[model samples]
Target: MSDIPPLRPLLIERPEDEGAETPATVPPVPDLDIAVPPPRLSRARNSALTRFAMWVFGALFSFVLSVAAWDFVTSLLARDSLLGWIAMVLVGLAIVTAVALAAREMAGFARMGRIDSLRTNAIEAALKADVKAARGVVSGLGALYSARPELAEAQVRLTARGAEMFDADGILGLAEQELLGPLDQAARREVEAAARQVATVTALVPLALADVATALYSNLRMIRRIAAIYGGRSGTLGSLRLMRGVFAHLAATGALAVGDDMIHSVAGGSVLSRISRRFGEGVVNGALTARVGVAAIDVCRPLPFRTLPRPKTSNLVSRALAGLFADADRNEKVK
Candidate 1:
């Protein structure tokens, strides 16, 4: 009894219901900053330098002519009459040869310039037509889809016409033919591949409608930036028109989730108003315009503009738009 009493005196205990939890500590997150290089100015400078060099060469020839003229006058005055006459004839002959050589070299260049101009015009025209056609198809499909959203069968059926219109081969038929068809094998393949992709992407009109709409917006913004850097020129009107046509088509199609009223409002704006925006910077800014201009000089140039390098870029939206009518005249493919 004495041993048990001694242990009982130490009993002091709390109530049973205490709840406690240790909180978890979180690690801090680090912010990452990535750096991208500035866009390439080399390509632009190269193009400008090349044109400047052509002008310089032309200027040098003029200088040579001036020197010859001065020499001819002095020789005539001194009149070792035979020597003067002989030197005069030789100078005339030399001038003629130089001119002939320059003309021969410049002919190809002139043709290239014209091709650039005409091809650009053709691209603008084709885009306008495609946009118009696309709008009609989109409007028709949108109306059908809106009224009968439940009818999946009807939706697919309605989209088929627009999709066909977007077909790559159908689009190719709109390009300048003679220039594109005779391209070397590798170049031809690249163009064909691009054409195929455009056609396939286009055939999914509803999806393309959204893509086109988004891309058009992005492209317009980007083009303006390029134009600011590149500055405006005559051919730039065509490029701006190309963008306008795409945006107009997308607006007309009612592709975005925006209300019908907004779509109609946008489409109501004058097409010309949209087209009058700025164009690109750099040396080859109107290069396509030059090429197309030359192509048009030929009567057999065909309906669609053709022959030219397809411009590729890290900027995908502008690149796609640029490529939209790229193969119109096949002749411009890089060899």
Candidate 2:
């Protein structure tokens, strides 16, 4: 302490500090230029009031439109009898078409319900091992497929061999083999096709929200077609229900995610991962679509996948994107 110098306060200052004056307002913060985040699933909630409001509005609008149309037709008729008759006829035709469309939609829902009933019956038969119930289920299955001209031969084969079975397992197993085999292939093809389309569109299209729209449309069509293949033949609303059910199951089971399966499925293991960001995202979207397809199959198939193995996401994705990479490579070489 004796050898040390005395402490002193020192203020360091720049030469320009005295002349530089502060501005009236603070300077704005600089942007870091970080990348924008990927879009997430919508989490908007619809309250009961919101739903009721929509229903009320729709009803009022529909009533107003109908009244206006009726008034227009009646006024036209009052002015000119021939023109009025023509207008009336046109309105009658429109009403008939509307009725027919509603009937068709109802029938579609009925068909979807029928598939569900068959699935339930199948589960009961399997659980109880009831031969009688199994036979009934098989009969219903045959009847269901009889309308499809493509399955006529398979139905015949099912009918011919279905009588000899004694045990419940054998009867349903035979039905699974004969009747549902072709349908399974048909459904798998649909899944692969949809996955391929989704991946292709996502990889190539650079527009905003393009992948989202493609995935939604592709998954919807895929579900509807898969339902049709299983004799559901769902209409727009039925298709939406099927889509919802499939996604619900996925959510409940925590299957709504990507995994190592994606790496293995798209373009020869990990090779495609390094190719392009768009291609990688495309693979993920496609893989998810394939998952939805599998779930749709489970929802729509009359009998559960007992004899036939359920499709794996990786296997479906591999087959789907195999040709995609080949075409991409060709394009690169050509360019």
Candidate 3:
């Protein structure tokens, strides 16, 4: 306080020597660039319209083809001539073949669609713990359960139990364990067997084309078998739909990447090394087949896994690859 001439009261005023700077305050502008998603109904409507268009086009094309065929037959022969009679006979056979094929395809489509609808209904019923709906869905699966009498009996018992139980979870759990469990096991085994078959074909068939054909045949057979296990028993069209569903599930679960990696790990070597190439291709194809099989199980399961954990893709790939390598090693040692 005694310092020379007590320090003048600390001046706190802005210095006049320099211009004062002020921060520019910006008013918040409303965001005009934000994107709003379209309504879901619009998208659904578009999809339905597209499907309708496709159906219309298909019908029109078939009609045109039938008319063209008739015209060609008429131009090729007089109606009274022997050649004309032969042509008519041939045309009749062709028509019968076409009709039979169309009927088969249509039936398959209907059956596959029905199975999908039934599964959805069953899942919903189980979630809601609705005894009547559950019973209805189970009864709808009679054709499927007929193939396995034990499963049919289990369904009957479950229906009776559902009537007694109040908890949705309990009823669903029992149903899953009693009814779906065997089908799951069977599907898993089918996939494993198909993988092994693919591996065997890949290893034994020297020709690439032959290997490709056999692999395709094996996969188709596997799909059919899986469909049958689920009580679908799809024909060619139904099988195609089943395969499509499987692929969709694989994509949804990100299993496709795992499957691809496994295949690449096994098949990345040069083709010039015949023995190695064959083994690698076989392992790769087998892994792919296994992935497809797993997808089928996921798609065909009547209910979503609430208590049970879904199978991990990595685990599946690991097991498939391990089995493949072990088999290869054993075979080599034997040789």
Candidate 4:
């Protein structure tokens, strides 16, 4: 058998094999045609609504004023008959105005209250810091002075009287007056020692506390400074005097406390005489107590509820009237 004989079909050409478009193909995408409203109409509508609301308000306001004016004119023409009515209306308006003014003033006063509290807090903080520094200084001075109190007392007395005790001319002159001759070698050494002690003590103490003490020496000083700030200067002189007396009493008490603290500190520390020699008994007694008192006094000073004297009601009324008159006078001058 011959296996070479197989029948093959003829080659056919397909038009779809070429990259040509067929008759059944759909068309490409068409351009979009959207209809948008004009923005000018929306803006115009908003403006028209706003104008209508404003016009309505203006018309209402004008109508109210016109009615009030008409009534006012009618009452004036009927003067004798409507006098009471006009007065009543006037009083009503005055009352309303007064109430509104009072409300506004009350709001302002409330704000002032907050500011006052803030100022008080600031003053308190500053005072505390000052007191702490002063306590350390005074305590150190107390220790130095305690070592030789006789000399310290003399110097303190001189300082109180505002004498120039520390200066070379003052010291030499005073020493000559007290001793009545040139200092012998031993006497000179003793005077030198006392002078040195005084200097040391003064150096240790704060000048600021001294400044405060000098500023507040009398009732007059206290009243002037305090009353000015608080707006109650009418009875300032009496207030100042009372405050000065109180301070003096307190200072005496403080001195006693200082002595007590010194005695306690010395006694409590050690049973041995050697221990007592270094830190005396008075040291502990006032050491903590005096500082505590100072802290308490500082805290009380700036409080709103102080027990200061008040002016009498009659006086207060007179003062108020005077203030009004003064204001009227000033207004007249300005005009």
User: Which candidate ranks first by lDDT, i.e. highest?
Assistant: 2
List model 4 lDDT by residue over 223-282, tens digit each. Answer: 333322322222323343334433443444342233332332323323323332322312
Task: Residues 1-335, candidate 2: write the lDDT tens digits.
Answer: 49989989998875775556477554754322121121111123589999999999989998998998889888998899898889889988998998888898888877877777787788789889999999999999988888788888888788788887788888999999989999999999999999999998999999999889999999999988988898888666666667777777666555567765455546655456446778778888888888888777777788877776767767788898888887765665677
Could you tally the backbone clashes for each prediction? 46, 1, 0, 13
TM-score of 2: 0.77
In the order shown, the candidates' Cα RMSDs to the true structure are 24.0, 16.0, 11.8, 38.1
lDDT of each: 0.36, 0.79, 0.65, 0.35
lDDT of predicted model 2: 0.79
lDDT of 1 at 78: 95
TM-score-sorted candidate list, best first: 2, 3, 1, 4
TM-score of each: 0.27, 0.77, 0.67, 0.16
lDDT tens digits, residues 201-300, model 1? 4323345255345333434443333322211111333344434433443344332222323212222223213321211111022222212212111211
Better by TM-score, candidate 3 or 2: 2
Candidate 3's TM-score reads 0.67
In candidate 2, the residue pairs with backbone N, CA or C atoms under 3 Å apart (3 or more residues apart, or in different chains) clash, namely: 77-84
- Give the winner by TM-score: 2
- Clashing residue pairs, candidate 3? none
